[model samples]
Target: MANIPVIAIVDDDEAVRTSLASLVRSIGYEASTYESGIDFLNRQSEDPSCMIVDVQMPVMTGDELQARLVEAGRRFPIIFMTAFPTDAVRQRVLAAGAHCCLSKPTGGDEIIRCLEEAMAGHAAQ
Candidate 1:
């Protein structure tokens, strides 16, 4: 459907990216996945969507990518997904305007909830 929201998932891990794509599509939204932040940026579609990005990556960290996006005047919703979550990192991402920071091993329901909230513009500050 044209009205269905699109979600962009950027992660270096093949398994994570593929799994996320499947899960997102299973929940009714369209999902596009990238192997790296640079790949996503280079071939980003013109869609008003939320981003689910891994915090640590080789080419660019999620925070760095977010910073660049902001500096370039691009304001899309972002939800950071990290396995190595830390207090300082969480605070930094929140301060940088991430919709939310989801610690890895988070359940499917929680991920969907985050996506729904982000699409509705109701994600946590």
Candidate 2:
């Protein structure tokens, strides 16, 4: 893979997707924005270096996407962001090997940190 990583931002809200993609791009990653998990699933080419997805979406939730990927025997680091944060959600995603669960209005530094952490872990393996 090339050193410059691809970071996918999946969210149903247009503004959220746009802002996050812009932030990712500003951080120097090749960014792709998707309106839903299913859209990403259908269109994703090579697996992204890191995935930033919203916890709640219209058709497909981020957790559902994670499950589907796992069912397909695929492993990748996911960073889930949500306006509503819960202990249960945190536990589940963490147990499933997600990179982090961040609350919305999350800082750009934090997002970048999580992406770097996710890629670092992947690289170690």
Candidate 1 structure lDDT: 0.89
Candidate 1 residue pairs that clash: none
- What digit string (tens of lDDT, one per residue) describes model 2 on residues 1-125? 38888888899999999999898888788898999988998999678888999998887899999999888877778999999999999999888878899999888899888889889999899
Worst 10 residues of 1 by lDDT: 116-125
Global lDDT scores for all candidate models: 0.89, 0.89
User: Per-residue lDDT for 39-75 in model 1, tens only?
Assistant: 8878985745788999999979999989988887888
**RMSD in angstroms, candidate 1?**
2.3
Clashes of each: 0, 0
Which parts of model 1 have CA positions greater than 4 angstroms off? Answer: 122-125
Q: Tally clashing residue pairs in candidate 2.
A: 0
Best by TM-score: 2
